[model samples]
Target: MNVKLKLPFVGEFGGTWAPQRAEAEAAWELYVELATRITYVELRPGEGLVREALTSVYSLFGTTRDILRRYGPAVSPADRAGELTFGTLALTVLNLSLRPMLARWHPRLLAWEDRRPDDVSKMDHENAWDQIGELRAKLEEARLGLVQLADVLAKVAGAAPLVVDPRLLSNPEKERGGG
Candidate 1:
């Protein structure tokens, strides 16, 4: 994945770019933490408060998006061989999967939070949410996408991910009936 490039004052620099590696490592670390947190958050279901769930997920999504922004540019040149770049893939995951879910849910959840009864505990309010089941399903989808993205980031960085999702062990394209 190494690519040669010309620097402003340094002439031709070769091998893996230092900035790219740094960004990749940083992005990888963030992805791992986010993926793990999302999984844990999803596992217990209605045990946590609605605000806690919404804010945590909202924060993670924003952070992940920011890391990908930096990481994508750094490694972009290394992946310009007409192959699908990690930048493109990361963008796809964010736009196609996470964005829509978060767009619809964040505002909806906030509205729900606004209407919470004065007497209701946070947990009780969350548990009573009519869309808890739907939210849980969206969380599962988002978690899977994050895990797959984390695996790809690990591959790019040549590091061992703490959590390797089983679904990603298989060829995802083939699983989806693509070559």
Candidate 2:
């Protein structure tokens, strides 16, 4: 029997945020360690760890969002001038750092869900796997968005102006694009 394995999204873009990558890797390791312990519980065993991991992930996300919000706008005037503001770098690092944690947690969460008892008799295992696949796809998209934002931030880091239209920043569409 051939068993299909699901893989997490891994990016090749490096150096633009190396420190962030290290931090993110460490965070992901911790998350995995904690998650493994939690998942072993025969009956909701890792509830506390799960909550803690969720809280950490949410906090990281919030920090990233705040940094992006603060630095997304504002153009740099010249090549010598620094366009990549501290806020923008912070956002990039945080986003990059969270990649591993997000990747691991997503799979664990899906596995847990898979083990869960199906209330509706009509619900099928294949359907559950499909749902997990969908969730994984969404996660990948989110990660890609962060990477793209980081790429833009890297360009700004190289003396690009931080000038963004203030009105655009306020707009939901621009906000989604990291302005």
Best by lDDT: 1
lDDT of 2 by residue, 142-162 (tens): 434443443344343342323
Compose the digit string of candidate 1's lDDT tens values, residues 30-125. Answer: 666665674433545755554565566567667766776665565456545444454544455556666677788888877877888999986787
Model 1 ranges off by over 4 Å: 1-27, 39-41, 65-72, 78-82, 164-179
Model 1, 144: alpha-carbon shift in Å? 1.5
Candidate 2, number of clashes: 8
Reference-based lDDT, each prediction: 0.60, 0.40
| TM-score for candidate 1, residues paired by index | 0.65
Which portions of model 2 show Cα errors greater than 4 Å?
1-47, 71-85, 117-179
| Per-candidate TM-score against the hidden true structure | 0.65, 0.30
| Candidate 2 all-Cα RMSD | 18.6
